[model samples]
Target chain A: MTTQTANIATTRTGFGAYVLALTVGVALLTVSGMAQATVLHDAAHDQRHAMAFPCH
Target chain B: MSKNLLSSAVFAGLIAGSVAALLQFLFVIPLLLEGELYETGARLHFLSDGMTQSEKGTPGLGGEWDRHIMTVVFNVISYTGYALVLVAAMGFAKAQRGLELSANSGLIWGLCGFIAVQLAPAVGLPPELPGTPAAELAPRQVWWLSTIIATAVGLSLIAFARTGLWQIAGGILILLPHLIGAPHLDTYFGVAPPELSAEFVTQSLGMAAIGWSVMGYFAGYFLSRSED
Candidate 1:
């Protein structure tokens, strides 16, 4: 019982987990936002297809 | 030189981000799909269909799955930003004394942080997308209430589950900007549909809260175990 409790308790110790998680979080925001923004801008580039002109 | 503080923050951030993302996928996404909030809420329908319509580009569930994956990816990324801030806090808090790293306290602080940063912004801020005329002006109250509760609860889990002084500090720091409020630029183009805005804001806060909570929980978990 004591060993189990100790193991469980140990899980919450130290600062390594926190910093690692922080880095992952920051990376996700920076990288993914850029990726999505790039995709959006490319779609809006207006060169994908020629606009059909209206004939009066 | 114990790397306890720095290491803990990183681990906690990932755990929190994952947990928050899962919660979002499970409860929040379903709510968003089924809720009347989007139907009645302000929404933005972009003229150019962006990544949201990728399914049309590729055949079958690939597009559907891709979008889901994107949601998880984006959610995690946002949390990552929050985590960086928490890391700085841990380093600072480690230098100080008298700060208790109790799980319960962390949760309370996490919840308060969510309210300060996310909810407070809604008071004067207009919805981002377009929606039905009625909802455009007065959205369903569920928009605010549901989001607030979801976010508070999600973040509290992380805070309450963790253990450490620095962990506690990191948790609070993660939430600081939202609590004090982020800088905003007025006169932005496009707004969310009424139904979706409520859902999106709630989801945004929920994701953020959980991300911070993860930082707290893991920080506490690792710090308690590390040899001091």
Candidate 2:
């Protein structure tokens, strides 16, 4: 049972899953933090300022 | 495996992001509304024209429900995204270094997050009020991105490296971007008063500190729970 559980744990902590989390997280953050479209900028203006992202 | 990771990110992001949004409503938005007036020429500071009208600071929400709603939405998304990144990194640390993830460890991660994401890059590009002058967008963004990347790598080394040489390399990484310097306008100028600008910087960082810390806490909490 312990070995079975360890296998499960290791599979969940595997490289592929972590990479997916990182890639998606980074993509979302870029949208929220660095997107430059005027509409997106307008929507996120206060947030940009608050996050200290470069803003005009 | 991915399911567990995704669930943890989603739940933690939602709760922590809401907390961050509430804090923004309480502190960040009013000052922002006031600053917007300066941006639009509704209010003027350092009066070059010698006009004598008092600043009409935003004392209320002013019925701009749409804008406020947008602010709340954006705050949630931003903080959630931050949580995802932090939790993913924690997962890596757990796998590679045998580090434990828990609420307490998450707080330290949160501090590191704030330092890497906001505080470090901010040394070159401090938070700007709406009307504050800044360098051209592209260069500033480039500098900002590089600075955060360097700081994150440097911080990881400092936190996890076993050797003095590796840690020293990390130290150099942290300083490298600042040494390169952030792109800035050749001359300093702005439409907002210096005092308001300074307060914005302070309050913005404070709010961010709160946001990142909470996000880190929950990210650790949820990820650990899901793994078990």
Candidate 3:
């Protein structure tokens, strides 16, 4: 990784977009990583196991 | 978000998630199938007479067509989510710290992500297998998330900090979650053989490392390409 030191205000991809991406990303993770519904758990059982999420 | 950013993230995620699911299908699922049998009492590792049973039956890819599809779908979605966070992080690293990550360096970024999300947290809560008795789900999830966050923040600080004091603080952050400890049941027990359980954890982590590194390369590739 190299360093460019571009000003945030005039950056290539604005900081707001990165924040937005972060928000949407975390939401998806919450669904896959933390949802507790039985249907959800059953569907994601193998994935939960593979990803090492805590499961019943 | 730029169209380029979104598309790049999606593309990277699709490839990464697919690779992860493939690895699970090939190496991890068979063990899981075997472990599940032990979980359901369909197979017993320890006989009542104290004579250890070596093996009863091979794990099957039974005709659970629907369920299998769901597993595949979830794996893809999960990695896509992970890729979004990763690429956006690289973007943040550039915007805030002036770190420019090219496709090549993305491998290191990916490894850092693996450590923060998998390896570091696993120190406290090792990857669990089917039928392994565990503590309450809620507390374990909380600890897991805390460990991931602390490790991620700590690593970036160490990587970006210019001074020794800041680096030491980063080390402490990485250690904080383990020091507190993962929540666990009072008694240690598992229906699956200890050997089987250990393999599941090792293979899962190994697969994740590869998946993350590939995703990081693509994410960085697209992100840099998008800027051109």
Candidate 4:
């Protein structure tokens, strides 16, 4: 019973970690996509236009 | 443990992104290029003096290759990011509320995502053309972010809340941001013709709606398959 509980706990921890990573990854991608920094803006320029986000 | 979820989101993002890019290439880009011509003074909407003006030549494929490639790559990446967020939200809903995340249901979820992320906020701030002038960016960004969060939370409550009171609260949340209003300029200052701007806004939103629907369906489909 103790072993089974430990296995379940480990699975939950692993799942939590995966979720955290995904959240961070997506957040970073979104920020960079919207960032005003020259390189990032240029990289995402076409997308910014395509999405109709305000770009001068 | 939830590796399948991540993989499924990636797959859905790729498919949805490709679809969106193709649609934009076919429909949106031409309008955008035409708008740029007006912005650059190459294309005049109406003559200031009573003189017949020659039509401007169409922009050729000169240095747009690099930009075009970047657009495809960025579209895929951004859509994939959006899919990740949607899938993560779905996972949370399933874990917490015992909600089923199947393809058909994903369609609804995707539409909700579109409303929260695109449609609702767009009510105040319609899509702008390349040369369109606007208010300060910082305030606009703040309003946009707040509106998206409020709408998302409001929508989830409406969908998942069991009580009528909670549903009413959700409705309030959805409307609160709009009530506050999005930042806007006192005067309209745009170089592009009003008709062109209006058309751009409509086309942009229409494309977005389609993209969101496709992404939602595929994300849900992949997640359901992964479950099995």
Candidate 5:
């Protein structure tokens, strides 16, 4: 393949890698968020609002 | 693209996501909570009768780790959303052009995500800790500055290092959520406190952007080094 064509091929391959990585990253983020929801809710929840920074 | 290249990119994404999540969890949250911004903002909200704290508007310290976990959880949710968007974008683009997503690209992408998603919604939502009277607009401002600075530094490292394409993808993965936007209180209130509400959206979006950039840089480094 010509030099430019080779470069294009390289880029395509790299782009594919990026897409796949993005998929996995999303999955991890989702799971992590779910794992910490309870803690976030407890610390910042409505009932505790008064103790923290009551808005109303 | 070859299987090796694809594998590296995927690996980079995972690394970037994780790093971004950790930074927010371990560093950003604590800084915001401890800084004067929190107190000043909270005080403003308290004055406005905007918050309803159990302790008569006292901003309690819920252990340092409490904030840490909150940051972590938030980052995770935000990053996950970004990843989904990336997948869709890639599918639509249909033409893979690069082996690795550059660090600078990741940061630029992050800014795009923040503006499109978080900054827009913040136009109506408050930034105070929910149920608190504290205005928290100061901290929100700080958040914006911090996000920009952090993303710029992290993405630059990735771009210059030439580590791998995966890191770039990871950055993009973290960024997508900010671009897509997140849920806020604006949907409920008609005449919400302007400053507070606006700050809230911007801050949330900014945090996500920072996390994504960090993830992208770290992931790129890790995956690029791995022989697998």
Candidate 6:
């Protein structure tokens, strides 16, 4: 591959990974936010509080 | 992501998460347990034997080994998740802007992360103790999300934007969330005393700031070292 081709490939891969990371981060946070008052919610309870996400 | 970058992030996450966990165990957990005492009516602030008092209840952490383990697991996962986002952003910035990511810059990055994720939203929504009453969840969540995104973008512009106009725009974005205001109940109803709640909020934010600083340091250190 030419150097330009390699650069394009690298950029594409990086963009893909960045999107994946962002999606995962958003999903994790949403799950935590929408979690009902259950053990799973409790597991993340302190963190939610510490992060100041407005849990009652 | 490159293997080295991924590995560095994992290593940083593990170490940073562990440090945060240990600090939480030492400093924050006790306050939580104490707050729970108020939540469960296990402890009262001002009442004598002759005076009327609510019946005591089991402490929150009592016979809850599974819950404790879950907290540890959750914390590690949370930090790792945060590290993933931070490292990814770091990579994108470097690739797009030719910005440098070194251990020194990591500290600032981590602080920015803490500000974007914790402090900015917190300005509107301070940490709450267990059993504290709050507004409906959905709206609060929306406001919180917007606050984080706005603050992150705003801070980035303030730091990275070359021109004064862009910097002013960033400042506006930072304040926009607060300008809209966080959802809150008309009435304040807190089972825990104001003092305990105040202490909990202070300690919680303090501990988190430390954790983010350490995580940023390690992430930058490892990423730069890996490059070398």
Report per-candidate TM-score of chain A alone.
0.42, 0.74, 0.70, 0.43, 0.36, 0.57
lDDT of 4 at B114: 88
lDDT of 5 by residue, B1-228 (tens): 444333434444455445664544343333334333444454332334666332222233466665545544444444545534443333223343334444444455545544433343333233343433333444443433344334434444454445667567547644543464433433432222344434443444455466555544433343334322
lDDT of 4 by residue, B1-228 (tens): 267567777888888888888887776776677778888887877567945344533354347788777777877887788888888788777767778879999999889988998898789878776777788988887888789889999999998899999999999999999999999999976766677777777887788788889999998999777665
1 against 5, candidate with superior TM-score: 1
**Alpha carbon lDDT of each predicted model:** 0.43, 0.81, 0.83, 0.77, 0.42, 0.76
Better model by lDDT: candidate 1 vs candidate 6 = 6
Please provide, for model 1 over B93-203, each residue's C-alpha lDDT reduced to its tens digit, 9 standing for 90 to 100. 543433455444445444464453345435334223222222331232333333444444445444444567655655564454346442343444433333445664555
**TM-score (0 to 1) of chain B, per candidate?**
0.49, 0.94, 0.94, 0.92, 0.41, 0.90
> Highest DockQ, which number?
2
In Å, what is the interface RMSD of model 1?
13.8
Point out the higher-scoring one by TM-score: 1 or 2: 2
DockQ head-to-head 5 vs 6, winner: 6
Sorted into a CAPRI-style docking class, model 4 comes out as: acceptable
What is candidate 5's lDDT per residue for A1-56, written digit by digit as tens? 58777566544444545566556545653344222366545543321211111122
Cα-based lDDT at residue B62, candidate 3: 78
Cα lDDT tens digits, model 6, B70-153, are 667666767777777888788778778877889899999999999998888878888887778889878888898899899999
Order of quality (DockQ): 2, 3, 6, 4, 5, 1
Candidate that scores best on lDDT = 3
Clashes of each: 66, 0, 1, 0, 43, 0
lDDT of 4 at B168: 92
Q: Summarize candidate 2's per-residue lDDT along B1-228 as a digit string, tens digits.
A: 566667777777777778777887777777877888888987777576875445645665578778778877877777777777787788888888989888889888888999999899888888988877888889988898888889999999999999999999999999999998999888987777667777888888888888888878887787677655
Which stretches in model 2 have alpha-carbon errors above 4 Å?
A: A1-12, B49-57
